[model samples]
Target: MIVSTNDGQFDQLIDDLSRLPTYTIGRATTNSIVVANGKISGQHARLIQCTPTCFIFEDLSSKNGSFVNEVRIARKVVDKQDTLRLADTTFDIDTLLALLKAEPVKAEKPVPPVSITPKLLSEVESNSLNFTEEFADLKQVYEQYPKLRKDCRNREKMIRTGSVILSSIVSISAVVSTGGAALPLLHVLSGAGLSVLIPTLCSTLLSTEEKLEVIDKEYRERYRCPNPACRDPFGTREWELLAQQKTCRRCQAIWVQ
Candidate 1:
């Protein structure tokens, strides 16, 4: 789709311009939208089989606006032989024809399709099954790591603490100035310092929580049962099983160990 607008009027005219191509520009062709001199040059110009289709142009709200048949059109499509006026300048219909005729004609070519055989289809199906099994195994590993959820929560808490501190300082300063207090400048400085300190404490606490979460995630991902029968990594309590339990979550088979 092609859209055009004046220097500062694109936003206001975009909706109208969007609806034009759907109605005028037919399917089965490649289209070009041209914007020139702060107005639609050709809004719905299509290349059908490499041949030019009907050219459509419209005006966007402009200081030096568009006029059709000597009538000012803030937004309207123009066809061949349509007189276009911009500001005090006038354009004859033949001028557009000459411009369209100047464009070089383009040749169209046909596209070929490919044929698929049963062997190729079978291989594709086999690869798909292998990918599904690998994905299932990864999902099982991810589900075992509870630290992912904990780390996310801690990061959120840190962001909220920082925002709250900034907001509180701004709010306190506004309230104090509004009261018209005769308090000394030192008092205001102390209040500001206190606000900074509160958020800093909260942020530090959240950061420590996150650091521990990272360590836990790392350890859980690295540790796995060496036993060949139950070599799965433990994650949350839901996935963790007691020692001597004989089920493999990924394969859902009995564990030898």
Candidate 2:
């Protein structure tokens, strides 16, 4: 059996769950199934396979909690037929199994060994030009960070605005439904509950933090040393300074044409 989700990073990975009787699911990389969504807790949930087909799913007191087929569950018996949800990501267990079973396995092609030879002058220059091009690409990706950050902020702002508008409408509807017959205290409490609860729930359900994380991950992947051998991550370092240096510190690769 395999455990997987239709979430980022883990989408293409097919990790066998039968290898371990128990498996953890969370945002942390150390988890058996890492889910990078913002709504997922670092140690969100655990799955235990008691038998070949029987499994137990338990929530680790996560903020959002776990749901099986749309019903919130603290602990429940689940199998391949059941669908599991963690935060915004949902996993169709049966679909995953079917996908894996239907996939055709391809045999690995063996690579032939290449004979070592001295680098020619033209080859050396060609590599330098390639590195320069790669460096320029990295700079372009680095420049996109500011816009990505702004987009994340804008999305969060939109969600907040929508939540407020929706919550206000729900509160007004609740109070109007009372037809002014209820006590003043009852009206105040009901309105407060509707407004606060609706917005809070909406905010939790539609968070932009996951999108921000994905942007950061992609930036780090793209903004790195041009040298393939030493792809050292220059975390949040100034791109202008890197360009001025003209060479990679780790690999001493030329970053200029």
Candidate 3:
């Protein structure tokens, strides 16, 4: 049975589900049951005795999230005892059965069995046996302190070089303008001041080894997993853990790091 939140387009949702061939259970039509506030609204659980062996519930992409039992479920199949939450309403198995009670049972033909070829089965087995291990090398690379230190040094050097260039320009201008002057010394004084200021400004602009260390520390702290299932938090050390990891130690949840 397809169920969704009654967000003004109830008729449209019913129409869409009714069009599907799998929806026909006995002679019951789409209008056999009605949905209200995410629940069955008026039916009893005994009605589900006439329900088809298999049923599908589409989310209809409601505004609020959907939950099966207490866990949030993405678009997928559901089973008995699963409680669905749509917006603010909750529909348990009993509620679903109750709603189905109002609909008349219709005769349905048995579905044909699907067959799989030997070639397809072999292909699936072959593909399933192969597992990629690219992330292992990547993890080792990130663990190396030398690479991180070198990166930090390179960044610091670039900033220092820019500072030196700005200071040199200021110093040269000061020397040239003050070559023979004592009275009109303001230009030289200004240039000398600028030379120191420029270097200081460049140094301030560039990130040093100490700053990078701090950034790394903060990143590790933020990304670290306190959960036992996902102990190794630094799965993707690239740019705040961008890579994917097959397993999380603290949570044991496989995900892209």
Top lDDT model: 2
TM-score of 2: 0.38
Error of 3 at 17 (Å): 16
* Model 2 per-residue lDDT tens digits across residues 22-114: 577888888867777899999998875432333567899999989999999988766666799988789865432332212476988999986
- Residue 182's lDDT within candidate 1 is 17
Model 1 TM-score, 2 decimals: 0.20
lDDT of 1 by residue, 107-151 (tens): 878668656699988887654323223223333344423433343
lDDT of 2 at 37: 89
What value of lDDT does candidate 1 attain over all alpha carbons? 0.36
Please give the lDDT score at residue 166 for candidate 1.
37
- Count residue pairs with overlapping backbones in model 2: 0
**Model 2 ranges off by over 4 Å:** 1-102, 108-111, 119-130, 153-206
- How far out, in Å, is residue 123 in model 2? 4.1
lDDT of 3: 0.36
